[model samples]
Target: MRQGTLCLLFSLLLLTPRVQAEEAAPSGKTAPFSLSAGSQISELQQQLKESERQRDELSKQLQTASNEHETALLGRLRQENQRLKLQLKEARATATPRLLTDQQQWFVIGGGVTLLAALCGILASGGHRKRRQWLN
Candidate 1:
């Protein structure tokens, strides 16, 4: 009896399909098996290439946009610089030029005062020193 049961199990196993049923069964019905691994891989590769091309296009657009923005900013800065330069030139043209600046004038006045003080000291001292009798 055991030998007969083992033979029956072996025959059952051999006769059954090796492939497992798909997870998404519908109304107690098993889905048909179709193998298209190569086609699916090719489709995924094509999608990857298309995405890469789109990324490259977006990156190029970003670069052009940044370059344009920088150019506009540079032009604006240059115009502002030119305007400031013109203002400076006009100020220099309109202002009065001086032979002696304030600092130089103050220095000259200080020197004159020093000379007058020296002359006054010389006159007040009577221009000579008397010898002391204690030294002899």
Candidate 2:
């Protein structure tokens, strides 16, 4: 009985076409029968081109928005720089130019005082050669 059933099953398998054997899927749907390689490549190329175009458009929109934002910021910065420059110019113009700084004036007064003291000491010593003795 087993030998008879195996023989029958082998005969049925030989009678069916190999291509038609895979026609029906487990889901009961008939898959594509004849898809050429060239058609699949062209379909993929079309999808790629559409995706690239969308990406370019999105990038352009992002760049335009950023440029507008930067333009406004640049204008504000320029205005601030101009205002600061004017303030600096006004400050410089209002300040007085001095012939000498406070430190230099103090040095000049000290030198004059030192010179006056040296002259007074020389005059007070008198022109006596005996008083000019180095040993004393």
Query: How large is the C-alpha RMSD of every model relative to the true structure?
Result: 15.9, 15.8
Q: What are the models' TM-scores?
A: 0.55, 0.47
**Runs in model 1 with CA error above 4 Å?**
1-40, 101-110, 123-136
Query: Per-residue lDDT of 5-69 in model 1, one digit per residue for the tens?
Result: 99999988876664443344588776654558667878899999999999999999999999999
| Model 2 C-alpha lDDT per residue in residues 11-93, reported as the tens digit of each score | 88887877566754568665554567668878999999999999999999999999999999999999999999999999999
Best by lDDT: 1
Off by over 4 Å in 2: 1-37, 101-136
* Model 1: lDDT to the true structure: 0.90
- What is the number of backbone collisions in each predicted candidate, taken in the order shown? 0, 0
**How does each model score on lDDT?**
0.90, 0.89
